[model samples]
Structures are given as C-alpha cells and as structure tokens.
Target: MEKKNNRYSLLLVGLAVLLVVGLVFTVGRSKKPTLNVYNWSEYLPAEIITAFEKEFGVKVNYDTYSSNEEMLAKLSTGATGYDIVVPSDYAVSIMIHQDLALPLDKEALPNLANIDPRFLDLYFDPGNVYSVPYLWGTLGIAYNKTKVEEPVTSWEILWDPKYKGRIVVVDDMREIIGMALQTLGKSRNSTDPAELMAAKAKLATLVPAIKAFDSDNPKGHLLSGEAWLGVLWSGDAALAGMENPDITYVLPEEGGGLWMENLVIPKGSRNPELAHEFINFILRPEVSAKLAEAFPHGNPNQAAHALIDPEILNNPASYPPAEALEKAEWLIDVGEATVLYDQIWTEIKGGR
Candidate 1:
C-alpha cells in the first residue's frame, strides 16, 4: 500500500508541472504587444490605425498634440512609453540633440529607398539617421476669392487694415513670425536678432487686424467666411477648398517656409519591432495614398502620389509646382535663436 501511494503522488506532481507550463505559455500568447504612436493633431487617417491593428493583432494607442513644444514636454517625463512620434523638421533636430530619440536601424526598413532623395540628407538628420520624411509643403495664404477683389500673392494681405477682424493666422510662433520675416526678404530660419525683431515689428502691424490665433483648425476660419484671409499649411488650405472652391491659396513673392513632418522612434519604447511594422505599413503605396486622401497633405511618396485623385494631385494649393519650391527655405534648428524667437513672440502675442 505504501509503494502504490508513492507512485500516485509522483504522477500527480508531474501533471501539476505540465499544467503550470501550459498556463504560462497560454498567458504569453494571449498578451499582444501594444504599439504607442504620438503624432500631430489630425495628421493621419483613422482607418490606417484600424487596419494595422487588424493585420498585426497588436493594439495601437494613438495620441496627438498641437505643437512640438507640447509634445516635448510630455515626452520629457519618460512615462508615456510612446514607441513612435512624428515631429516637424526642426523639432526632430531638437529632439535628437536632447537624446530623446533613437537612431533608426536601416536594415529593418527596406522601403527607405522609396522616399524622394530631395527630402533625404536634410540638415536635420544627415543620412536620415533619426527620422523619415512623411510629408512636405509650404506655408501659404488661404483667402476667400469672392471677398477679395484682386489676386492675392503677397503676405501683406494678412496685415491689411481693410481686413481688420477678418484675418486669421496660425498660432505657431515660428510659423507666424516666419511669414513676417519672409515678407521682409529674410529666411524663415533666420538667426539674426535684428531680423527676428524686425519680423516681430511686422507681426505687430498685423495683430489687431487678426480675428484669432488658431492652430488646430485654421481652415474653419476660412470655411465659415468669418475671416477672409488666413495663413495656412498647404494641407489645411486644400481641405478648405474642398468645401468652398472660392478659397484660394497663394505663395508669396518673397517665398515662404517650406516645412516637412517626419516620423521618428522615441527612446526606450516597449515595442520597437511593432513600431517598425507600423512605419513599413504606412510606407506602402496604398496606405500612403489613403493618408494623402484623408488629410490632403503633400505626400512625399512618389508612388502614392500616382494613386491619388488627379484633381487633388493637380490642386495648386496642396501641391505647389516645383518652381514655387525653389525659392522656399526649409526651417533648420536655430540652437540659441529658438529662445530669441520665443521672447519676440511672447512680446508680440502678449501685446507687451
């Protein structure tokens, strides 16, 4: 009787060990890794994220911010655990300097060759180390053609006293000030204290004429016809025109800021592989085209551009011709100049 009991006890112990191992394996397989993406407000199509979730069986937690500074502040805390982030050209440079991002592993992304070479090797990330170009466009004026009597081709219209309480501009400091600087025949990325101050003065002249400083939906101002003219990103202008064709986009004679938004991986993410997969998925021509169709931004994917509707592709406001791109200046990080720009912006906006 004693021998039989010992044999049964041993068998029961072995079954317990097998059950524990099976439970561990099942738990591991059940927990799908999550990918976190932080991007600009209204920057992406909703369906793309859904599609990624469906295909990869991973949950995507997407969030957005209106400004680069806001994004930086949240990310500085290191608690967000975001796997991917999309920041504008200058912001990418700043993040890289502060060690907020990781250098991408090029071997993992074979689709890197699809990006236009013109956008590659930018001053921000030489050799495209930390970021990949997502979209590129110039800052231009969007105005109601029916309200304005003449052709608008200059930044001066935003300052016109005749349009007092009828003008809107982006709330962004660099972009708003850049418009003024470019109007004064200076680079948008100008580091000269005197030039920035001059730009401040120009902005001062337009302040009272403006209705409100808006960032998220500058197009709403134009669409409602509450403001006849506004400074708009090319994508916003295109969206506005779709609702009202009378809204016209104008590139100033003195040139405007040419901006590019890019995708980057922040440091210490939980799911770098999943983030890479998301990036690769978006780079696919069809997925890229869907983003362009949804947001109307200037897509850098040449293959995606072919997939977009001809009317959208032909839209002057959204995709300005190569000639217009020639005179425009891409914004570069201005190290110490950022503080100066902020001071001037504070003085102007605060009316001090």
Candidate 2:
C-alpha cells in the first residue's frame, strides 16, 4: 500500500511540472511580437517581408487590398488591428483628415533623408508628418509598336474610331473619368457639375472603343494582342513591356494622373515600434532597390537609384522625364464630387 501511494504522489508531481511548463510556453508565444501590415495587392515583394521578419524575430501578418477605398473602409471602421498601411495620393489626405493615420516618429526613421526631395512636401502631406512616400507612378498609354502607327503622344488618339474593339482601360471610375477630363483640359478632380457632365458625356462615346475594362490584368489584354492600345499605370506598363518587347508606354502630352502610395501607421496600431522599424527598413537603399527591381514602380528613394538597374531606372515609361510631370496633376479628393464620379461610372458601366 505504501509503494502504491508513492507512485501516485510521483505521478501528481510530474503532471504539475508538465502544466507549469505548458503554461510558460503558451504565455511566451502569446507575448511574441507581431506586426500586421495591410497594403495594395502585389505591391510589396515577398522577400522583403521575409527579410524583415528574419531580422526582427517577429511574425508579420501581411494582408492586401485591391483598392485604396477597400483599405480605407477597413481602417475607418476600426474593424482591423492593422499596424502598417499604404495609402495613395489623395487617400493620404483622406486618412489624415479622418485621423486614421497616426503621426510617424521621424527620429526612428533616420533613413528618411534618403527620399527624393522632389517627391516630398506635396499637398497631400506637408513635411510628411504622418506618411512616408514609398512608390509612385503615372497613368499613361501603353500600345503595341507593331499595331499602332499613329502618334501616341496625346489622349485624343484613344478616341479615334479606328481603334474601336482593340482598346482596354482600367475599370476604375476615377482613372477612366480622369482621362476624359484631362483630355478635355479639365481637372481630374473637377467638382464643377458642368465639367463632370462633359466628362461623363465623353466617356459614353469611349465605351464603344473599350473592349474590356480590367484593372487586374489590363496588361494581359495588351500582351495577348487583344488590346492594341489603352490606359495603364506606369508600373503595369513596365511589366507588360517585359512580357512583350513590342509594347511601348508613353505619358500623354496632355498630362495624366500622378499617384504616390505611401507607408503610414494607422491609428490604434498594436506595435508602433515595429511598424516604424519596418518603415525604416524599407527606406534602406538596398531594400528599396530590391523592391524597385521586383515591382518596377517609380521609386522615391533617390539613394536607391544607384542600386537599381539602369534599364528600369532609365525606362521612360517607368521613369518619365521631369518635364512630363511638370504638367501632371495629382488626383485629390473631390469632396462630394465623388458622387458625380460614381454616377458617371455607374451610368456608363451599367449600360454595358
């Protein structure tokens, strides 16, 4: 009886030890640091995140959204615990005004000085108190050299009836409507009902020319030879050109939209320290060069230019001349004019 009682006592001690060890392990894992990053789909390189995670010894929960509006919706509703977010152009202003973005710690970001001065002090973010410009590009025309004979310098070429059924455009209302407005010599952010209505009228005519409205893979159409010419973002155009050397990208002489996607910390971030670290990590010239090499966007990190391939850095489509941007306009929040923008898109797309 004594021997049996000792065995039971020993079993209890071992069980207690196991429970204590299990509790400690569980708590340690629970306290393990994590960063939640939300960004545009395919905007960030996979290796970049891996490098950050490896360097920091923390897990990064990366998520993506297709549009700035989608990202804004999740953040503005306070539905997410996202630590880092990338907002573009006017979306930066919207998030700032809505208090969705928190001020960045400049001291934590010493590498911020590496940014191009030309990309800084814009109307969207004066002094960049709340955001850091990450990648930027322009909306322009991409055409097949073999298929297109006419000069592709102007937006007017898109409206030519000869190219009907061979042109593709981004599905976004702002991009399409913005093009029409720019073509008409009006502001892309035009709030005037008359100007918006005029753009709406002109877009209806373009519907016949548009073979399809695809934001996801407009390049696919362009590469497949289904689309001879269409409007595309500079980064997408660059990618398309790689797949098919015959494709040529040009910034319209009329000046199209210029957009910059920036890295920002949202309000209520769980890990502000790590978020700042990640932002600073991205600003590192080598890392920025890696991102530019993978994404082919207009990198704002001037220091990284030396590290980037001359082919990408010198590509006129990817990096247009300064004069092209002199007349370029950054798309901004048109206030209530978004209603008009929506109506125009709905009316045009609804008919189709």
Candidate 3:
C-alpha cells in the first residue's frame, strides 16, 4: 500500500510539471507581433500580404479607405493602431505640413534604390523623406468601342449631346473639377475663383447627361454597358481594358491629372520598424512587379519594369507615351484655396 501511494504521488507531480511547461510554451508562441496597414481599397494584391506574413511570421491587420480625405479625417481624430498608410502626392504634402506622417529611416529601406529617380524628390515630400511612390497613373477617359460612334480622344466627348445618360464620371470632386479645369485650359490647382466658377458651370451643364458619379467601381458601369464612357484613373481603365477587350483608354487632348500614390508611415505608429520592413518588402523588384500586374498602374520601381508581363508593359494605358506625359500635370497642394474648391464643388454638385 505504501509503494502504491508513492507511485500515485509521482504521477501527479509529473502531470503538474507537464502542464506548466505547456502553458509557458503556448504563452510565448501566442505573442506574435501585428502590423496594421491602412491603404486604398483594392490597391494591394492578396498574395503580397500573404507572402509578407509567411516570410516574417508577423500578422498583418489590413484596412482600406476610399479617399485621402476619409483617411485623414480618421487619423485626425487621434485614433491609434495604424502602422502604415498609403496617401497620394498632394495628401502626403498636407500630412507632412500637419505633422501627421513620420520621417522614414533610409538605412532600413535599402531597397529604395529600386525606385526610379524621376519619381523621387518631387515638389511634394521633396528629398523623399516621408513617403515613397507606390503606383502612379493619369486620369483619362475610357470608352467602349461598340457604344461610341466617334473616336473619343478629347474630354469634350463627355459633353456631347449624343452620349447623354451614357457617361460616368468619377465621384471625386477634385478629379471631376480638375477635368473641367483642364478642359478650360486652366490649372487643376487653380485658385482663381473665376476659373473655378467656369469649371463648375461646365460640370453643371454636363450633369444632366451623366449616368452616374462613381469612384469605387466606375469600371463596373462600363463593363455592364450601363455607361458607354467614363472618366477613370488609368489603372481602372487598364482593368476595364483587360476584362473587356472592347474598352479603350485614351489621354484626352486637353491633358489630365497625373497622380502618384505613396506609402507612408503615419505619426504615432506602434510598429515603425515593421512598417519600414513592409515598405522595403514592397519595393523589392519581384514584389513591385506583382503589384503592377495586380493594379495595372505605372510602376515607379525601375527595377521592377523588367519583370512585368510583356503585354502589360506594352499597354499604352499603363505606360502613356512621352507626349501624353509631357502634357500631364501633377496635383499640388493649393493651400487655403482648397476652401474655395470645396465651395465650388458643393455648388456644382448641388446644381446651383
């Protein structure tokens, strides 16, 4: 009986030791680091995120916002937990001025060498201190070849009476008004109230003809044959072209907005080093090429250009000719004039 009791006591002690060891292992293994990324909707490919997770064993919490304004408003509220953000060129300038973005550590981003020099040290975020260009594109017109009687080479095609109720315009106020401004031979960043009013008037005149104002999925309308023509970002146009070969993208004769979406680390990030790691990961030639394939945008990574699909590389919409690029203008921070733009845009949308 004494020997049996000793054996029972030994079994209980062994079980207790095993339980403690298991708990310690579980706790240590469960504390994986997380990276929170806020980006534009549909901007990144799923495989990129999956690959990053697999490589680093760091969990990614990805979220998306539609516009720069929406992202800025959320960040302005002092809400935390975002380790990275993707903002456009002008928005980067605003965030920098407002001290909403953090300076990037160049040493950590050695892969920055892959980016083309042409995209760097721009007027916005000059010296490339706080942001890195991700994808760039022009705002242009996309038209279904079967629906349009005439070749669409100009922005004036939107105002044509024949296309009434068959046109889709981007919902973005800046982009829409910028198109009008460009058509009227004025700067997209025009602060002149007269120029803005003229642009608003033009838009108001065309409003009755417009089928819908859509940003999230203008390509859907075009694909469904609901909208015969649309003012779209070049990337969206490229997507439309791929899904339906009948669709064609053209840079209007009047020129258009050239935009560069950039990757930035917002202030108060919990994981700055991880953010840098992710940026460098994205900048890798192969990864950058994959991003271009997914989004069909103009890749700023020169090294990645060689790795892109030949068909995509040859597509004029994805890589506009030199003349088109020469005519294109980048949207710049217009300072307090933005208030006037807001007012004008409201008037246009309100049908005033």
Model 1 clash tally, residue pairs: 0
Per-residue C-alpha lDDT of model 2 across residues 249-337, encoded as one tens digit per residue: 98888898799999999999989999999999999999999999999899999999999999999887789899988887888888887
lDDT of 1 by residue, 1-352 (tens): 9999999999999999999999999976888888999998888888999999999988889999888889988888876799999989989988898899888888877777777788898988999888988988888888898998787878877766779999988898888888889999988889998999898988898898889899888999999889999888888899899999999797887787788999899988888888888888888889988988888878888777788888888888878878877887777877888899889989997996
Whole-model alpha-carbon lDDT for candidate 3: 0.91
How would you encode candidate 3's per-residue C-alpha lDDT over 1-352 as one tens digit per residue?
Answer: 9999999999999999999999999976887888999999999999999999999989999999998999999888895789999999999999998899999999999999999998999989889999998999999999999989687778999999999999998898788888999999888888888998899888899989999999889999999999999999899899999999999888988887799999999999999999999999999999999999888999999999999998998887799887978888888878888888888878877878
Model 2 CA RMSD to the hidden true structure, in angstroms: 3.1
Residue 54, model 1, lDDT? 97
**Candidate 2 wrongly placed segments (more than 4 Å):** 1-30
lDDT, candidate 1, residue 58?
84
RMSD of each: 5.1, 3.1, 2.5
lDDT head-to-head 1 vs 3, winner: 3
TM-score of each: 0.89, 0.92, 0.92
| Clashes per model (N, Cα, C within 3 A) | 0, 0, 0
Model 3 misplaced stretches (Cα beyond 4 Å): 1-31
- Residue 183 lDDT (model 2): 93
